[model samples]
Target: MSIVTDNPFLRLSGAVQAEGIDLGVAAHYGNPMIEQRHLLAGTAIVDLSHRGVLSVSGPDRLIWLNSVATQRLDRLEPGESAETLLLDGTGRIEHDIRVLDDGTTTWLLVEAGELPGLHAWLDSMRFMLRVEVADRTAEFATIGSMAADPAAESASVRLAAAAPNGLPLVWHDPWAVVTRGGWQYAAPEGHPAADWRWSEVLVPREELVVLVARVESADSGVAGVLALEALRIAAWRPRRATEVDQKTIPHELDWLRSAVHLDKGCYRGQETVAKVHNLGHPPRRLVMLHLDGSDTVLPLHGDEVFAEKTRPEAEAGWRVVGAVTSAALHHELGPIALAVIKRAVPVSVPLEVHSHGEVVAASQVVVVPPGAGAAADVPRLPRLGVRGL
Candidate 1:
């Protein structure tokens, strides 16, 4: 709904800036399908200057962050990449922070329009702690790529991550595998995400001018947010920016696979995270939809999803089941989307999505299984011992 319109990359020929939530950055360099192929081959880069960057420094940064977030950061070693979520009092996701502690300052990368609130919240929580928070978004920006490991490999050494007397501030994506104490609620490690070698490098804002020159050169290539979103959907990745709402919890989207640590100590909403995970099931589940490509419809955020009722009570009309949160047309997969549906909705049922006054048929591939929660093993009471006789 917001726009960051004056990006330098917009000066490049054929560069089309994206609108809506990803408003400010280039959506594609003329052809999105070609961009998708370039991204998949690890030869393209996406300018993510639209993201927000922050820094948390001082002696108590790690423990302070650990106490307020869902991930364990107390022992986060330098050069280690982790993801954490800040939850509300009831354990619903409030903020998602991509964390990288370089043994000096903890660098946080958040979605566009999230920095001000997160910065204020962290500042208010300081309460005499030996930590300080600063918004560095103006000084730094993000560049994302499908480099198996950006810091280790030389995808584009010219855009080396900013290192102010420490390790490069590149966040190697932990979503490719579960972090310490995290759980996997989706398909296991060998799933499509295994092939998702993504990383984000924090570079100096001033360096973007030079980076763009290289991008426009004959040796480099650039892709758009459309390409990135399509690949992310194919990988079954849950993006906190658009996938979540007021009712969102970690289990509903299988975010426990990386952003949550079940064994971690108390934090806001930890109880609900534990309860639904260890005793009861989450009320909803996430699924990937294969949209019928015969139509020209592309669903957007909050597009209604319905179950086609073929029963005798068909007069009741199609039952609303969920809504599409993100959609993209992959170069290979055609039209696809990530939708959140009620857990009680049978996975085998036929589905459809309504957008722009057109209804398109859909089929779901489960991400978070209906029986995902209730993970703890508890022994049954021994038949109550016949009323204690």
Candidate 2:
């Protein structure tokens, strides 16, 4: 039987449950601004039980995972964490997974909506390999926070994860810096992820009441899903569930910085991965849109983004260049969003977001630049003997 994921945090006073895409979880605890501050201070915990948990075990788990994923996992050490993407044959993203190895077993965390597809794919691919895959969502729940290290001496509360084989199940995000065999497309000097210390800890389902007690006693703070979403946008974090579409490739959102290993061995979509990074550019690019505050409205995903034409026709209609992938009303930034725009759009040009019968004037803060990828730099040798004719 599937376990019901009724969130325990919703019992708290002023804890408003989020609706729409991420339902069944708290959206905020009365004050979103205060919740954001608490998260940054590492005193707040976000309930992520709605996320899916899967496991793979046996001797060839890492090798099997490495053979099919975008990141190298064959040599992953115990307690180490990584992230990977499962792409379709044509190079479009299908599933985004957070990977953590604990010696005896590897825990895979994914969006709840993607659990079935991911599990089915893994089970089918296990042919004769010494690997096992199972859905563990019934036995485990996910907790998210900005805690850099839960094992630290100065940690606010002593929290532990399920450790059937002695290694705790904590998946630290590797997005703060570019990982090995990866490339960075954003301007490196002033990237926003400098202060992003996000991590997810997996605890047994029965411990929900224990965590609730801490929040009740004021020993630990509890924030809502909106708090995390706001911070994620501010940090320029691109999550596959929100940022990716049917046509998404790693380079488009600067996702190659962490989720992709360019030098990895052959995988499902390596041909397209190599071809785009070395010889071509992603058709679309990612940008942060600083929305006009006068409108006082948030743009939803798939909202059309337009740009004024820079061509000879001065009176043409506003052309649609891209659409918003995710947006949030940040505590500090007023209204900001992460959008995927055309690669040909000029970085300096201002943008407009059409949402809720209003057009919000916006400006682009480049994330994945128009010229991202094509790092090979192979010079064009003058053709045979016809040099400079």
Candidate 3:
């Protein structure tokens, strides 16, 4: 059951619910281009109620979580935010969380589908700990803003001030910076997320009405998941549902940028993470595809992506290398997508995406380059009889 099934915001905004948790508010309001523009200009709010919230309260909250998640959380300051990932024994990504800590409680923000499993795992791990994990999704709703700092804006300011329990809980994105214990896999020059100013604030479920009323009267507009997604893709951000496959490892998606703390203490799957980062390349790599717009067709998730064979005698005309994870029509970039292809796929080859019986040509924009490995840069020893000896 959808948490927001009875949400008044849907009727108030005349939002058309998307296939899943996404309520297409912009789809309802019309003019997606304008909606996207508003989002980029930091003059819009997005309903992210589909996301889940969990509260962890106890004296050992930070320490216990630090032992479980990839990021270093023991030192996370009050009101500070960070991202972490849960990996399987082989370092395959299972969960991605956005974390925020208040003085007394740690809040975890995750996909709606992840709540039950995440809560269950956390509970099972609390056999002897002082922590208490509870699913707070039913009590709190998330509102997102791309504003550089939501505290400075009118809409966010109004929402923050109206928090029934004091200031609205805001999770400012830490993706823009290379965090204290995190490493960057992308080249330092021009990572797309460098300018991303994302923030999500928690508002009481009942207080959504007040926030919605304020937005309708203000000059700022309301955007839907569509607008948020387009911007996120353009920034080369990796989402949990779209980007993650059962075999996905954090290195494949350049997740080291924000989610993994290479220097963090031991955690589950840490060995595989360290092994892959220090000794081997991930089997797959994430890429951004700029599709040819002449076809007027966009690839959907799970659409096959192929590499066009150049030789005349090629056995298979096109080899399947990957599948599209997320696709969107950017207001400025037209059609674009993020796909996870085999790491061996040559970056220079022309690509094609097959979706809905239509083939769309694509050009690769490297996100996780083929050589993204050995992030630790450990020096190799000289040969036994080398001159240096």
Candidate 4:
């Protein structure tokens, strides 16, 4: 069922319903390029109410959350925000959460589809802890924007100004920096997300209508999911639904840059995480694809990506190596996408994406490099019986 079935945003003319989360809003409000510019200029309001929110309260909230999540939150200050992940027993990412603490309650922002399961898991893990979990989705909605606006000095000020009801709790994205205890796989200086000044604010669900009206009345730009997705892909951001597969680990998506705390104490999949970072490479790597826009057939999610095989023993001229996770037509960059492929796929090779009996040419821009792990450079111990030279 779509979460926006009764959302007031549907009243906007030209609104289109997307599959997931029922993102029923004007995809562009008539000019997508303008909307993109608004986002970059910090003048856009993005409707992200499709996401879910959960509240954790009580004395043990912080400790209990820090124990289970990948990010360190034991010392999280009130109104401060962080990103974390919930991995399965094998270190595969199961849930990605944006966390915010407001002193009394901890707010967890998660994908709508994963909400029920994540809430249940947190409930089950609270065996003896004083933490109390409650679903805040019905009462709260999320609004996203870039933090680059010079007028608003802080997230609190911006959110408060936008919400007439009162100050809404905000969660600023931690992707811009390498948090303490986290490791960054991407180059520090040139990462696409380095300049991404993004933040999401939680507002009373009933206030969404008022917020939208204010934005439109002020001539402040408004963008939908399509615009946000394009900017995200262009910034090389990996979202859970697009970048993660069943076998995915944080290392595979370069999630260590912000989400994983390498030195954190034991969690569900910490051993596998440590082993992979110290001694092994992720089996797959994430890559950005600049799709050829001349053909007009953009590949969709799950479209098979193939590479031209050079060896004579190859059965076909091409071999299927990966699949497109997200594809978007950027207002400035045209058609672009993000894909996860076998780590062995040569970065030099021009890739092909097969969708609907059409082949779309794609060129790779490495995101997670082929050699993605063994970053710690742990020294190998000498043989037990051998003498040191």
Candidate 5:
């Protein structure tokens, strides 16, 4: 068997074909059904052998991590995992990951295929932090699931468990060790199990392979990339590289509530987060889009969205607040997308979601703090300087 490098999708029987990527010799034996089942019914084991896994060690690892990431890292107990953000100096997200605090070491699980870059980023920042970073993405295979599991939420880490049928339950989580069931998963040629990368329930990869595999298996090999895309759009989850814009501020994306610590001591992007929340408004707001069937394919990433007054509105449409980071045709909902709209647009007005030549219907999903939007005067906080300028 040829070694699988950056693209772990090649390991799956039909992922390469369904995705339409040329996998060279692997194309000779394609099984789309197996790929589909990995998403919907039985347990499908996927080799996310290509994801970026990093080990951040040293006595100062905790303090060093606490300073760079948005979450309060100093307090996480072993076996605990969380969705965390890496913010720019302005408090905007640079990257996001599922951070795991294994009793002795801290693992930064980044999107698949980004390990080398993340490793370099960690290295550049290692001026005097006493932290050492290593890329171990190729060391092990990771499996995942949204399948129903009776044993889920146990003493051990449960990645995800859900029952689709009345009595049919499935357990889903990525397994790090070796396995040879319906599917055979092996680390790219040279690597052995001992070099197994960080294995956990949380998904830190940028791509959808791990989650897709779990869904395919649980769904009896009937799940497809399209179905997973629909689920993601419905969940309103951020797609990291796609949904987050370079100029975007994290708080506007709701990172404060889900990804940041307001009361924690200063870090690099503290000032930006505080200033935006206290003195200014969010530049863009994340919104869900509904696409019409006029177009067969979903909108492309970075497509513009228009809110206009004329019948076949064009030049006068509202400039894009942000673009389509990710989109998919839903099984139940036809077509759907997640976009970042400018705050200036009225949330109540109906809008047109557009790609190069395609247009879709979109409505804003207003996200206000618990008691906000209902109150006459919204509360405010004072600003102060912290680690980030």
Candidate 6:
């Protein structure tokens, strides 16, 4: 009963559905609605229906979107999408979106369940442009692909996958242009060049309930958030709000290459990004922490990380060099976490994740480029949690 795209090959075989994973903590995850690991292992799809989709149209669509977003939209043609970002005046991330170009209309696909916030942000910034923005989450079902074939070739409602050349290629006109990840294409909705020109994903909003039922019956279940987290962490990808907190800036989290266009003109937060890259030093560096013990309870999103031998009293563990922003129990890697650590800490030193009192053993995994710690004073530390706080 699960819904598959109109590919006859996929339809002939039994319907394969996504399964959801159980994220250890409640607040850190969205819904236990999918099993994300399966998506990474092979070809799997997730019902991203919970995500939000928006449309921007009007004569000023290209000009306005180009001016406001972090990335350039003027270079894209019909049937293309790019991972773009929206930053506050300080260059800290405000929102991240996927920009889809359907030849005529521009689409913005945002995180599911985050439409209201994204919409509000867009509205607040709206002034005098021919652009018109509308929430289209209710109008279409959004699905994610981890297929081996390029995402564009898959039988999707529309294609927003990257081309071999890394271009944000689009395949159809989007009522809501959908970027796979990032923010960038928040344009005015009215230009003839940004108008809908191809066939769109045409599911009516009223049938969502039935579609859910069909989707459930076909695939065993959607991949849960845990699997997705594992996949994302492995990919070294950064997320908004969750990964970039009040303490985070674009350069520290690697957003400059993926989301920010350094060569582009000024926007909100441009100065911060520029200064940090050129002059100021980022306080902390983003790293992947691999937990050692199977019994260890994975740290929560904001749980403190400490150097065990540094201190031994309450609030005395080196004052916590960093904290876990997101974590997952990797089936293959045991417990794992994404942490933001101070650049002064040793890269290979054993560390402990302090979940109140419970200590989890962790080792630093080199994911991003070398930082101040690459040549720091790192002793061959003992097992994680060798010293208590």
lDDT of each: 0.88, 0.89, 0.83, 0.81, 0.53, 0.57
For model 4, the superposed segments whose C-alpha errors exceed 4 Å read 1-4, 21-26, 149-158, 161-168, 313-316, 380-389
Off by over 4 Å in 1: 1-5, 151-153, 156-158, 310-316, 381-389
Clash list (residue pairs), candidate 1: 91-269
C-alpha RMSD values across all candidates: 2.4, 1.5, 2.7, 3.0, 12.4, 12.5
Clashes of each: 1, 0, 0, 0, 36, 62
Where is model 2 more than 4 Å wrong at Cα? 1-3, 151-153, 381-386
- Report the number of the highest-TM-score candidate: 2
For candidate 4, give the lDDT of residue 368: 85
Give the lDDT ranking, best first: 2, 1, 3, 4, 6, 5
Model 1, position 210, has a per-residue lDDT of 79
Model 5 per-residue lDDT tens digits across residues 1-389: 11344544445455443332212212212443344334334333333333356677787888888878766778766655555577778777788776765556677766654556667787898898777887644443333334444225541224342111221112122122222111111122442222222223333333335444543454323233444445545555455656776787665555444466666777778787767665566667766777776667578777887765443455455555556667776555666777776666666666776666656776645532221112124574556754444
Q: How far is candidate 5 from the true structure (C-alpha RMSD, Å)?
A: 12.4
lDDT of 6 by residue, 200-230 (tens): 2323344434444544465323343456666
- Candidate 2 colliding pairs, count: 0
Evaluated with lDDT, which candidate comes out highest? Answer: 2
Which has the higher TM-score value, candidate number 4 or candidate number 5?
A: 4
Off by over 4 Å in 6: 1-37, 112-114, 149-221, 308-318, 369-389
Q: Give the TM-score of candidate 6.
A: 0.70
TM-scores of all candidate predictions against the true structure: 0.95, 0.97, 0.92, 0.91, 0.68, 0.70
- Once fitted onto the true fold, the runs of candidate 5 whose alpha carbons sit more than 4 angstroms away are 1-13, 17-47, 128-130, 148-226, 309-321, 367-389
Evaluated against the true structure, the overall lDDT of model 5 is 0.53
RMSD over all Cα atoms, model 2: 1.5
